[model samples]
Target chain A: MKPAPFQYLAPRSIEETVELLREHGEDAKVLAGGQSLVPMLNFRLARPAVLIDVNSVTGLDGIEVEDGTLSVGATTRQRTLERRLSAGGSGAQDGGWALLGEAAGHIGHLHIRTRGTVGGSLAHADPAAELPAAVSALGATLVARSRDGEREIAPHEFFQGFFTTALRPDELLTRVRVPSWPEGTRSCLLEVSRRRGDFAQVAVAAVVAMADGRVVRAGVALAGVGASTVEAPDVAAGLVGEVPRPQLIAELADDLCARLDPPSDTHGSAGYRRALAGHLLQRALLDATSPTGAAAAA
Target chain B: MDVQQESVVDPAAAGPAAGVQEVTIRVTVNGAVHERPVPVRTSLVDFLREDLGLTGSHVGCEHGVCGACTVLLDAEPVRGCLLFAVQADGHEVTTVEALATGDELHPLQQAFWEHHGLQCGFCTPGILLTAYDLLRERHGVSEAEIREALSGNLCRCTGYQGIVRSIQAADESWER
Candidate 1:
């Protein structure tokens, strides 16, 4: 497997990466973990003129919690974050910690996870992928910087379309900041894939807050169903101003299905995807709202 | 001007190939540092196997599906097949060869042998380093988590059951 010839530069710091990026301009691609970019190179799918290796950059692989927000550096590898989050070392706030940790545990395999960076995945912007959906569902902020300045993009606005992001040339994602887990809120992610490690045909992430045993706030995001994450505002509205019951989640599922027109992909038939979307959405919502947290959770 | 942070490229030396001009890169692999001039396009897998004489990190599929080329990049497991040698310059990279202190097998390696974690052993190095990275974190990973963690690696021999078991046992008992 041969790739197109390209110049390589190993930059030692983010400032260097930014400078080198300015030097190379649109011809260069930032080498994060290379889990995705390398494959694209081998397949001859990507042919960048220069590669700015950002691995040597210090302070870009850190995960820190500051002032009610969790900030994850763009270069932080997935396995490292999974390990840190699972170990509760990210100092996650209430509802966000457990679910983010749970979601991290479900990403690809050890080797892929070890080398794959969340920023890379976010930058690559695969619509059917998990991290993008998780970030969207959790409403994380995407931060990108270039030689000129930095820009902040919300999850809903970050994704431009399938395989496309709002990031401009010469800009690199620097970090993702997510809201602290709110009180009385529980969340869960349910994904259905034909095989392990394959892209999800349909995946759902749900967050529900209960006040005195009554549903107060809800957020729902689905991946692998559309060009970007399909946020079910109606489904979330269904839960809110109502109570947490099996019937309500089921109703939300039906309403969400009606709202989202899932596209047909190789993984599954369009009809099959729609059906699974409803089913998975219902199940994910129920799991999030579960009092025991073990009932029907896999 | 933001896109021209570095000193302006002289107009006399501008071309498509100029953007990708080859350069020398020095890499520290396993224990030794290698200083050599290679084309900018060569991957790290080729450099380790061909230049440095470290072949333990296997290259399976070459498309990043098989984990045969897994190695530790700055103590983190990564597919060697995917990175360019230029990227590893100045980093402490530990391949499968560096797992043992002397002749003593890394506990994860020992567990794989006793548990029959491998059948043909073609995918062992990839699996070994992957598990090595996973076990580094505390807080008890679950069985389902173990399966998800290794999903990037495809074992053609179908020895995943024992493979998972080996990683599970190693996570509980292995030490640095």
Candidate 2:
């Protein structure tokens, strides 16, 4: 279970870190929280020649809001994000970012979240991870940096497939920018995991905006039902300009299930995951449309 | 941060070397400071057990699934196996050994003993540290909250009923 031998470098600044990344290219791996990477390293699944520990790097671990847009530093601990959202009077709940906290709580236990970085989770791109689907449902933008410069990639582009991303070897994911949801927006993230804190068997993220009892805008995304965080744009579009009803939600969930070709593993069969995805999506949509907008786990 | 900057290898010089590379790290474990050279690949739990001689933190499922390697890094509970020893440089680590003062057991430890929280005792140390962090963060934690917080730590014996009671009893008696 020991990790392969490798040289360790802790850079003090983003520029130096990116420089190191540029120099080592594919040979180096950035060590953020090490919640995911170290496990892979210990299993000998990943054997990078150089490990760039980024915990020492400054300016990469804070949550900021400007002009109604939420900008979360890439290395911000998931626990920190959860605390901020759960802490009343932070305006996080009022700012339409509370769904992030809901999803963050579903991550591995408190011990894991204390060390897991948001950027690491997003970049890791696990098909069943909560943060990626949550961010995808929020229409977040990911910022990647290299020695050359910084570039922004939308969530759809950021998550390519299971454990794969659009990030280049030399690029370090630096920040995630979540645009403010339209006023009166309600959101929820619900999942069905075998056990609490375990990876979700199937999870759903839903954001809906209503005007005069009719849906004006909606964003829906699912995880563990596809190779990547699957955005159901067509399903979301179907909700637009329509009144959110139980029948409508049931039909949309059926459409989503039909569209999903989920992978089957020891945790569950493909059919089970597909059914779970549909059920969770329906529950998520109903919860989002609820007056309290509180999420309940399946 | 009075870190030894000179000991840090220059990023430019760090290449694709297959040989073992040891880095000097100054970490405070259980309120005692120690400086040691650890291999870059050595996990924090290994460093604690081997170098510091604090064997309370057990290593089961080194892949971060089992909470047997839980420890406090900077006063927060984290998987010791998930962190590299080198990453503990200039950080404070609290292990299970630090919970008690001399002959007297910590409140959690005492509660566990009184509640029969262990049978095999393999997963007790990690659970203690994890519970310590939880109690430190908040007072008057309910049963549901305690169960939720401890979902990560898997206890094979006692069926977690005694463990939950121990935490609840400790929470009532825990002092800031």
Candidate 3:
């Protein structure tokens, strides 16, 4: 089936883009990579009157690491970030970018990754999406721009619900800022999908900051268990200053599994997703606490 | 400010009365540049097949799940059905028709035929183009790597054993 008819506009700059948005307001949809929007269009799930293609917008496709904050432009493709992360000197063993690289790898296939943008995925806010969960775990901030001005939104406040975000119709996500990991931080991402490139049935992204082989701080976030990516701050607090072992991890997993309630869909049952989320979190914790070559060098 | 815009299709002819809009896009498909007016809703696959008369790229799942409609946009493989023709304005597109030179089959095509890589042939074009991109980018790819790369392109026929062998054979023969 074809998409519903709409007018197409390609703006050359952010100022022009915001102007177009302001003019069209709720009637316009910003087309970033078009990986998510196009699908919705094809399915007729989204039928906007105007499609503001942001591909022509200048300076919206960059990745910069300044003062330990990784600023990714809204239009930066997943493949670009993945390539940067796995390249020499920033191998998968590296902490900060490696966690994201690992999560990016779990996203759809190479073709999807080639066109899927960081901002599009975040703004689409798919609960089963890996980028949002990883970004949430990393404590990233999303920057939104409109004709009025720009504002930074925390990850928690940014994601509203399933396929929903705090972004207004006349605003566009312009940048995502991911802060550097703590000095001795190690991170891991674990996802359980039906197939290799399918959306995660349950996934976990964890970051562990160790001091003398003990956990000084930790961050845990889950996907595919709720309306949006859920961050488990309480669990992270409980792991502080404690030695990360299989036993402790297993106990936490069991406890969370018993207490948590996950949404049920055709993919899996609520109980099954809760249990799987716990298992993935446990595995992520194990991987995060384990010493890698980069960690040993650090 | 005159933002860059092009509309090839006439709005009236393409269902303007029903609130449908049309856009004229200049696309270079298979080395031929054609300025055509198409409905704003026309996907790259539909535009190539319906407007440009290039049906080499078949549409399977229009929602971007199946790779049957995969094509190269600016040398990178992307889901054609997931991209509108207007999105291809000022861009180069390569469909399966460009894989071979006249009567001479591409090395990947020869390998597929030699290894019995297809049965129904419905999924062959997409698999071929995707494998073409993979071989062009990476050298000496292992069988496991080939399988991983082909995971996105689903082939219900031949059980993918022959398909894997075909890509491995092409990699060996083409790399030499």
Candidate 4:
């Protein structure tokens, strides 16, 4: 199938890429890995007047952890992050759920992982996607650059709503910085999709921090629940300060389900999604609090 | 601030330059460089199959979903449907044709034959290229990683078990 006609410009360097974006203004879109954008073009979903192909942009993809934060380039391939986590490279503390890294490894198999970059995934802003939730749960920071200047936005503030971000028309995401995994942070990522590679119908990411063998801090986020991932704040509130107990976790999940806005589609109904959200949230919390994850959290 | 910021999917990103010029794109395919005046809109898969007469890279989905058009870009396997021929300028491309040196089939090709890896053969080229890159680059890849890497390419008839096994066996033997 032929893509709709459009202009193509391959900028040799990042400076040139920024200049190209500056020249094209609102009609331009920056092309990185193209795993997401090209398909959208083929389907005729997005038709831009100019495409600044930055595949050749050197020094755009890499990951570095300094101090207490892990800074990952927007073009960093998902597999690369997965590999890093496999080697126990979780930022300063390594207290959060390492399950997120495993989930990163499972995204769309290996070929997609090779090309489906982490930045593109977040920029695509699919609510059912994994990285967004992973980053958001970690309270990450997104850095966007334009010819005008650069701006850093928190994950909660960066994501406006479904398929929507705070990114400007001329802005391009550069990197995402995730704070160190909090001490006593037990985290888990869970999804119930029709197929493994397919997008999940309902997914949940949670972190439960325990102090002195008691739950002291908890952060839970749900994807495919609404336009963007919703942190289960009130629900997690119920779990915090409680002793390690499965029934209380289940109760917290049920309370959290009431706050989600799941949309019905071919995959499952809104009601089903809510149910899955609660059940999966409970399961994820269990997995995160289990002995296997207990060590990581500690 | 004194320039135009064209968006993605624009005529500039999706079309020829303002002059509509046919630039000669040189690609080293299977260790041979072929230079031809290719339109700015041509896809790498088309350039390989239609222009260079290398049909090993099949286009199943025309999107990146199907691994039918998988090819090695500078020894790194990537989806050809998602790349433009111009992007491959001066890069080394290895298609299914590169598998046979002279008259001998590569070991991966032989493994497929021995293990019945291909039922329809539509996805054989992609599987071969992906396996080749994996075996060549990552000699010690685990079976789980091998399965995940090949997940992008689909096989309708072999149920993928045979294909995965074939790739595993090939990687062990080649040790590249």
Candidate 5:
């Protein structure tokens, strides 16, 4: 399949990019890594009159950490972030940041990650995508910029529905700000995909902070089970002030399954997704609570 | 749109286009620079095959799922089908055409041949390029790592056994 005829505009700076976005508005689509958008364009699912290519824009690809917050520029490639975290360099050794790396690894394969951008994945808002779930579980802030100005959106507010977001047509996602986890915190992201790089049938992102062998705080988010990344505050709330054990995790997972309302598709039924989410949440909780968890090792 | 930019493809040469959007892209493929005028909607694989005549990168499943059109953009493996020709502007692309010097095949190609990594040869170019990137970037790569890296590139004939063996064999003697 070939993409439809569209005008291409390559803006070299954020100012120029936003100006073009404001000018084109609904008629234009921002081209980030093109991992997702180009495919849609090829399928003719999205036929914008103008495409504002932002790859040439400088200062929109940085990943920096400051004031206990990790700021990842919108266009930062997934592979770049994965490498930084895997190498345990660039302040990526933080527990919360490592969870992102683990999740990024599950986003397609090396080839896709090489070109896929963090912001592109988040802004695309694929329900089964790992980054959105990870960020939601981490309580990350998404920054959006328009000709008017910039505003920050929480994950719950950012992801409106499948393949949709709270982003205005003229606003560009500039950066994602993830707050650092408290000390002694551990996290994990686990998913069940048909293949190694396929979209997850069900995925879980869990963060647990323990002190004196008791859960101080916990965050749980499930993907591939709702209209958007579903944050299970009840499950997280259930674990707080309790000793994290196999029985406790199993009980919480059962509760999570009852609370979920997943879509049934050819790949999996709603019941299957609900059950898988429960299973994954249990494993994720176990991994996050253990000192040698998957995320910690990652 | 800056009109002052170097215009490799003259719009006037298009003979009064009827709403066709075109952009001039200067891309280096296989160490050779080619400046051409391509439609904005032209995928990089189409530009490589139709424009530059580098058909080594085949197009299968024009979407990102099938990696038959994989290539090295700026030394990183990516789906050429997922990128527009204009996106390749100012970027260096390495196609399967650059794998051999004269008659000597690259080590990866040699290994693939030894391991019978291909039965149809349609997916060879993408696999070789993908394996080339994998070998060049990581040393002492495990079989698991190679499999994970090659997951995007699908080969139905070989069942990936020979492909995995080929990459493993190449990794053993792979330098740099």
Candidate 6:
């Protein structure tokens, strides 16, 4: 169970950290909260010659709303984000950022949330991870930095494939910027995992806004059915300027079910994921459109 | 600009060579500061058990699946196995050993005993610390919340009925 030999370096500043990343390049792996990395290290699945510990890097743990975007620093722990979105936390209001709390609660166990970072989960890019789908549904932009400079990549472009990302070996994911919901916009997340806190078999995030009883905007994204969180543009387009009734949601969900072509795995079959995606999206939409504080049916 | 300028880079600066690297870390565990040089791969659980002789935090499923190696890092529950000793540098760690005071067992330990929360006691330490952190952090935690909080710690014995009862009893018996 012991991890292979590696050198650990703790850089005190972001510049020094970037320098370390540029120096080591692909040979070094950045360590955030270590919730996912250390487990892989112990299993000998990840063997980086040098580990650049970013936990000590300054100015990488802030959470704030800047210019209508909820900017989350790279090292912000998942538990911190969860609490901030909970009943009394900062995200309780203003753009429905509290929806992150719902998705964060479904991530692993409480201990894992305490140690897992938002950037770590997104960078890991697990198909079943709930955070990625939630962020994607929010249409968030990921910020990556290297020796050259910084570049902002959208979630759709950032996530390349299974456990693969557009992040270069010399780049460090520095932050994520999620555009806050407009006034009266509501959002919710739903996932059907095998166990209570396990990775989602099919996860969905729904953000919807209505003006004069007609849908003004909608964003729907699904996870666990593809390499990255699958955003339904057609569904979003069909939903605009229409009434979001039960029948309309059902039609959109049916279209989504037909569009997904998930692979079969030990956890579930391709058909099962396709069916699960439809149901999860339906439930998420219902929850988002329902009155606040009224519990959505399971 | 000053902060950026202050970041001096020395390309010739030494880093880990090949695979082996030794680093010194200072961790305050159970109210005592210990400084030691350990391999980069040494997990906090191993460092505590082997070097510091604090075996109260047990190691199970070293890949962080099982919560047997859970400990309070800076007052938050985290799996010690998932963290290298180097990560704990300049941090505070609370283990199961800190739960009792000399001859007197803490209220949580007493509640576990009175409620029969353990049979083999292998998972007790991790459960105890996990419950302790929950009780301290959150006030008036309900049964459902208790179950959710302790969900990470897996207790094969007692089927978690007694463990849940113990935590509830501890909550009621404590002043909080």
Candidate 3 interface RMSD value: 2.6
Backbone N/Cα/C clashes per model: 6, 0, 5, 35, 0, 0
Using Cα atoms, each model's DockQ against the true complex is: 0.40, 0.55, 0.55, 0.37, 0.51, 0.43
* Cα lDDT tens digits for candidate 5, A218-280: 788888999998998888899999998889889989987998899999889999998888878
Cα lDDT tens digits for candidate 1, A1-298 = 3787666667777777887777787899888988788888899899888777777678788888889788899888786777677524555446755555556556666667777787998888777777877777677899988889888999888887887888877787899998875587777888898887767888888877777777787777888889877777778777776777888788778877877778886788878888999988888887777876664465
State each model's TM-score restricted to chain B: 0.83, 0.90, 0.90, 0.85, 0.89, 0.88
> What's model 6's lDDT at A55?
89
Across B123-156, the per-residue lDDT of candidate 2 in tens digits comes to 9999999899889978998899999888989998
CAPRI verdict on model 4?
A: acceptable
Say what the interface RMSD of candidate 4 is: 4.9
TM-score of each: 0.86, 0.95, 0.93, 0.88, 0.94, 0.95
lDDT of 4 by residue, B72-161 (tens): 887778889888787788899989998877788888898888888899999999999888877776676787777767778887888888
For residues A19-70, what per-residue lDDT tens digits would candidate 6 score against the true structure?
Answer: 8888899898889988889888888899987788888788888788898788
- Candidate 2, residue A74: Cα displacement in angstroms equals 0.8
Ordered from best to worst TM-score, the candidate numbers read 2, 6, 5, 3, 4, 1
All models, RMSD in angstroms: 4.0, 2.8, 3.0, 4.0, 2.9, 3.4
Q: Kindly report which residue pairs in candidate 1 clash with one another.
A: A96-A181, A109-B149, A109-B150, A109-B151, A110-B149, A110-B150
**Candidate 5 runs further than 4 Å off:** A87-90, A294-298, B1-18
- Kindly indicate the candidate among 1 and 2 with the higher TM-score: 2
Tens-digit lDDT track for model 4 on A3-41? 565677776656677777777868877777777788888
Q: What stretches of model 3 exceed 4 Å from their correct place?
A: A87-94, A293-298, B5-20
lDDT of 3 at B156: 88
DockQ of 3: 0.55
Q: Write the per-residue lDDT of candidate 5 for residues B1-176, one digit (tens) a residue.
A: 43112232446543222266667889999999999987877899999999988888999999898799999999999999999888899999999999988899888889898998899999899999889988887778888888888888989898999999988988886556
Model 6: lDDT to the true structure:
0.84
